[model samples]
Target: MPEIMSDTPTDFKHFIRIIGRGQRAGRTLTMQEAEQAMSMVINGQATAEQKGAFLMLLRVREETAEELAGFSQAFRTCSLASVADLSVDLDMGCYAGKRRHLPWFLLAVMLLAKNGKRIFLHGTHEPDSKRLYLKEVLPQIGFKVAQHPEQVQVALDTFGFAYMDLKQINPQLDDIIQLREQFGLRSCANTLARMLNPSHAAHCLQGIFHRKIDEKHRETAALLNDANVLCFRGEGGEVEFNPLRDVTLHVSRNGQQSSEDVTATCETFITKPQELDAKQLISVWTGEFDDIYANHAVVGTLSLMLVLVDKLDWTEAYQQAEQMWQGRDKKWPVVLPEDKSEVVPFDTTGKHYAH
Candidate 1:
């Protein structure tokens, strides 16, 4: 029963038969039928078997928070980047891809670019059979990878940190990375590829693994009024570091949202990474095990980037995360990677799935 276009359906097989008949009758679609079934899969007009039956019916009865804020407002109106200047942009990483570890948000964007803070970062690379990306661990940690989009705005205006990549800033959303490996799972293009912010950062710091996509990332940062967002539930979802607790952060300020339990203050600051499961964190991130789980995932990603730039509030962000784990060996080449086998160690036994 497809044909329902004009009277407000807008194709994509009439919004995938009204979200595959509300997931074949189990129901839950109205946020105007999940924003016309994500504006018919972001305007391509569905059809890869109706986008693999609306991504296996929104991955089996999940999605809400107004149907993930109507699929992040039909994916920020088919974004391609233009959400700049959210007060000196602060976008963070891990929109999935880096199964085990070593991607301490590329050393917390190189300590937020040696503390002047501009940072952008995007993904894609190490695709066909993944592992090792931040575009190959941020050029082994010195940070190049721009290659266009005006060298990612001249490396975010002179090395405050840039990166970009997603097949050079968006090759038709990186040609749907082979329909995300032909739906072997993950779609809505991996939550609209972490809401492709393009430095439209009104202070964002994403990292998802699921908690029902943190209400579609707080309704896509309150329909892009995005003044300060922070969605969490990280680790194997990539954005690692929570040695036995304090990871699940989720916030969304200025847009006003909330969440809690950061693993009892991130397990009271580090210490348990020498082969802690998941195929020994992918054999210590591929060097075949033991750089002390990439130095406790760069001191738990610089104490979760000083608790996302509040510069030490959550109990002084755990006493400056215990002086960043005793000056982590003079911040070891600023969080390793300059090709030390792309700092691996992460397979904490996968499968957390939700969004």
Candidate 2:
């Protein structure tokens, strides 16, 4: 007797069908459904077609807060392996590289690190991306790049800062992110990646390019019950506060039902960069150069993160940030090529291992 094969489609296909049911009938996924669907996507249970379809369908409509929250939870649960406990004071995401200007924000982060704030910073740069990503420039500034989770843990413990590329954090997610080459547009993967907050830090900072995604990001953190989250429209989509103009970023403290709005500290709207040079980031940090705009950008960015990281009010954070800037070592550290010590300044991903 021949046995009959069932015609049931894969569970992931239901997500595709529901999401792509045409504008008139399509509805967003519930938080639970979103979590389950993203888990399937991350775990390789979803067919390639289902994965693409679900992402594109959701891309057509901005993701709801619940969808963002659900997707973030799934990735955290399904990360490549248990990430090391870096005991990071902050989780900083830097997916977007800088183009119009140098990434002065690195100075802010380094300053905070020098003052004893351990930061676990993670990012991804597409194969074809031309922007000045952290991986390309950090070494020039005498920083060491840790390729593994254990390196990050040790870096944080030793130097108070660590950087990892997303590919090392979870190559699976990086593969999904690199899909932009095929899709010609961003999928939810791009948005969800920033909120992973792998260390489960008490304070997490996410910067978005689109204003539309600001509230959604803050809402997602709130939904995740993240203790402290700052989601803002950043300069060049990196986590730097634009010091030239007034702006607003959302903050959620202890998973507040609604996030509060935080505004920029500077109102000056224009400054001139005589020329663009990645080396300027180093020069500025070492007190060898001064760009009014760059200095404000660094201090402003630091103050913004300080509000959450140190629990200081915005005004106090800004003033303290200035003092930090003034008190920083006037010269960049020299990491002898022979010295591979954890105390040496580090660069980005090379290997990732759990502690």
Candidate 3:
């Protein structure tokens, strides 16, 4: 890193020094210190150079659960909290876009919303992302972006779901996130963004691109005392699963953390995934397309969520999800409404819970 200019603000300068002391002398920040460091960035007390240096240093050394917890806590301290009072059932953090396939998990969310689950989905779709973003597909499926923070409540009340970009929720973090452009790599911002529960929703779901970070996420949820959470290595870093690949899900329930190693289903369940297309999600939902992989992705994601929310076993959850899929509002979401809906945790061990 360039020498800290003599004019560097003391507010965040020490933090950079602490973490950038080279591998041997540098150590992880305590949750409190991490929180303090993040607070400076969020509150504009940190300079751009300091922000990049701090984040990239953590990225190189990797982030701990405590740091993730601290970062999220700090960010939320200044976040736009218009919907904090809502009784949201699920908090969905979907920042990673998909490159391998359509985000079928979205259809699962739509199904839950249709069935009266108040869900809040928050993330971003950068202009430079190479992968497909759900924001693009949301319009085709009758979802609206809450333009302002207040519109979030209306969308949830009227449609049972809502979405807001990070800029709308907390521009500071979004701005920090964009620093990836300058740094040429992602920082802890992406992970902590997923860790935010925003509304203290009853349940939360997190997906990470790296398997190693899965435990950090689960531990962070435990640290925050997240009521319930599911964390796993998701498809292309999304909250959707790769049915053909075994996934170990780290779940935290009522403050207790556990891991469930889910076995991969038959290779035939979802095979030969079609070329990426957002319309495929809508088509599959409308019964106009038959892609086994997409179908399994939807049902499996929905079933897993059912297990979390209703506490049902896997078999029953799958049955329930299949039924929900077969019984979804086939012709609903017929047209986009004129009014704007606003647009748009935890770690555990390797243990198996009997389904």
Candidate 4:
């Protein structure tokens, strides 16, 4: 009979050797190995030092699609709740909170919701900055943040959309992400989080800061067996498509490869944070504010989502998106009535801001 091999590693050190064997001597982990290793980290079986070393070593070489798929599967196993029965149309990730630009994509999502799409948005605002995280901006714009899975369902049932933070979805991974301050660099957690798709929506969109990571996102989604995923380099790394620059979108549908470049349609000179107004999100949505850049950004973003959902062809989608933006109701529930009875804790800069 032929010999059969088992997946048992001698120890954590043996697993570490697969990836940390030194610069030229190192090798990437097999998909199964990556999954087992990450599960150990998530399940609290790995030492703190081992976890740090594992993440840092992956960072040094950058992660591969198989590696990302394994990590993401492990994460999903640990954190994902059953929204599988819900009528979710999109899974949006906003992990890279806006820094260089206000979240124009937020308006795009609202536009989609208004058009009757059930969307779920999730993210974590790293304590490093107060620069317009979605957790803060959502409330300001009249959207509630769900701190629990049941609450996520409630928000979705009540509103067309809901936002969940990483800490709420998976505290262990959130703790790993916060390790940024300690490691002085991002680990694969950020990448995996973007691809998590907690609701297991049929379609997903990812925004990345670096142009180089575009392919990484597409390939990882493919490895995860996601039928439809669109990843592009957004303005400031949030999933909102940038209107100011030409962008090449990497797309994966049913493990097939396809890509296209979106030529810049608007040439605006506003790039700095001081030049942009956060309130414009509401202004534009309400049809009171008019800026060419904002208009194109919102429409362009909506057009992509529309295409992802197979609602329209790219060109037709753009035109229809413009129509939807022009005809958007000014009264789709911005802020709910407040009650002082219930107190909620807001996390800002690692300090508690309760109301």
Candidate 2 lDDT over residue span 7-75, tens digit each:
333767877777778788878888888887777777677888888888888888778999888888777
Least accurate 10 contiguous residues by lDDT in model 2: 346-355
The TM-scores of all predictions, comma-separated, are 0.32, 0.87, 0.88, 0.88
**Residue by residue across 1-355, what tens digits does model 1's lDDT show?**
1222454223555545554575355556665667666566545666566666777776665565667656656555554554353234577655566644456546546555655677677766423444445565555445577776667777666757776666555554555644656665555555556666655665667777665665567666765556777666666566555454455566666666666565533323344343322233233333354454454555556566667666355556656655644443332333433443434544445443333
Query: Tens-digit lDDT track for model 3 on 1-355?
Result: 1122234466587888888898899788888888877877765678777877888888888888888888888887767767677779999888887766778888888899999898888888654456566776677566777777578888888878888788788787788777766776777878878888776789998888776678878888898888899888888788887788888888888668888778765488443343555556667877888878887888888877887788777778888999998888776565745745433201112221110
Angstrom error at residue 341, model 2: 24
Could you arrange the candidates by TM-score from highest to lowest?
Answer: 4, 3, 2, 1
What TM value does model 2 have? Answer: 0.87
Q: Per-residue alpha-carbon lDDT of model 4 for 115-144, expressed as tens digits?
A: 788899988866554445788777655677
Error of 1 at 353 (Å): 20
- The lDDT values for all models are 0.57, 0.76, 0.77, 0.76
Candidate 1's TM-score: 0.32
What CA RMSD would you report for each candidate?
18.1, 6.9, 7.4, 5.2
